[model samples]
Target chain A: MQDIYILFQVAGVGIIVAIIHTVLKQMGKEDIAHWATLIGFIIVLVIVIDYLSRLFNQIKSVFILQMIL
Target chain B: MGSILQLFVIIMVAAMLVIIVREQNESISFLLVLLLGIFVFLFVLNQVEQLFNLFQSIVSKFDVSLLHLDTMIKVIGVAYLTEFISQLLKDAQLNSVAVKVEIVGKLFILLLALPIFISVLETLMSFIPQ
Candidate 1:
């Protein structure tokens, strides 16, 4: 349940960022728009990295991959 | 099955979102696809565990050595992990790197199976008439 919510949060951030970027660029603020997109990507990436770590741990436990990790 | 249906719906929605984002930001679209791939794998992980457990139980009933069973499992795991990573790399446009990774995986699997190969050879050698 919680996982689904986090996914939605990331998706929402992406959509919002895309909107903000397009709006800013329309106003002739290309640099600001680029920064906004980059920040959005970083935020989503942070969340994704956390999820990926959890996934890796789960894989380690499931596969008993003591040596590889 | 119901959960699979739910996953399908989620994936469809995510695909739509990715398509929408493609025109705006290509990298973000790629990220979305990558995230969806991970999500799908996570969703099916429990099934994978169940399958492994079933295989273990079935193999235990046989007279095969535990070492062989363990090696078999490890080889399967390595193959799967390698395929997954290589596919991701290919999706990221790293074709040459993906090919190298696959070669590495094949070599690792071969190494893991060496003990089994030795056992087979010894058994065959013992069949010769003294």
Candidate 2:
């Protein structure tokens, strides 16, 4: 639902960042392109972590088992 | 909701492919192509819940214990995704790394299924009337 909107936004931002990085690299800006790639990955990872945390909380509430080994 | 999102992903990918095949700048177009593929992947993830529910229903129709089914699914998921990742690594020309990763994944999956194998052996022993 609302989460889908977040997903779309994250995907869109990632694509834009990739395009920027590619354009910069083609213009011989290797350093900036590398930084941009790192930033894009971090942004995507942040979204992933947020999504995983939400799922973890939901699963914890649903399952009372303390076995995580 | 999930299907609509999937439709959007397909459209974007198709557009990106068209752009890549006709475009002169292969590197930039390739990067865009990669971005589109990743974006579609991210979008398809929103359907994970639907997939889980469908799996749940299919598992319910079987006579197998739910926990066993879950474990089986977990192992399968790990194996299948590892295969995907290893292939991607190979495509990137990291064949040695991919081989190592595949070996590690196979070992992990074997370990994961150990309990099930042990339980089956125990059941067989009981039937032998030791």
Candidate 3:
């Protein structure tokens, strides 16, 4: 349920970051824009990594991976 | 019907958004696609679990070895995990890496099938003169 919102959240972050980058680029702050992009990427990564781990864990348990290992 | 329609709409909208934003930020668009992929998988997970439950019950009724069933299920899981990863790699323009991941996945499925393979070999060997 709550998981679905994560898609929109990532999308929002991406769009917002893009706007920020474009704005900074116009001001000739390429270095700051680069930093902003990196920070946005990290933020998205942080949000996604949590769900990815949980999904993998669920997959493992559902597949009875413990028995195989 | 309504839920399916809703899912379709959401997916369409999200895809369009990703396309529009892709020109702006590569990393973020990649993450957006990743999130969308995970969300859809999670959305259908309940139905898949139900199907597996039904499969387990039927297998139990037949007095079949649950170990083999477990291995088969795990192989399926490996396939799924690999596809998830390989697709992400491909999305990131790493086609060779994606292919390698797929190869590794096949190898893992083979490893998991070893016991079953041996069982078949033993059955065949028993049919020959000892």
Clashes of each: 0, 0, 0
Instruction: At residue B129, give the lDDT of candidate 2.
Output: 64
Measured as a fraction from 0 to 1, the native contacts recovered by model 3 come to: 0.72
CA deviation > 4 Å runs, candidate 3: A67-69, B62-67
lDDT against the true structure, each candidate? 0.80, 0.59, 0.84
The number of the candidate with the highest DockQ is 3
Q: Docking category for candidate 3?
A: medium
TM-score of 1: 0.84
Q: Which ten residues in a row have the lowest lDDT in candidate 2 chain A?
A: A60-69
Q: Which residue pairs in model 1 clash with each other?
A: none
Please give, as one word, the docking class of candidate 1. acceptable
lDDT tens digits, residues B45-102, model 3?
7667888999999888887766687778888888888999999999999999999999
Error of 1 at B88 (Å): 2.1
**Tens digit of per-residue lDDT, candidate 2, span B8-125:** 8665755655364324333333333334444444454446546766777877887446667566655655665466558756655679999998998888778878999999998899
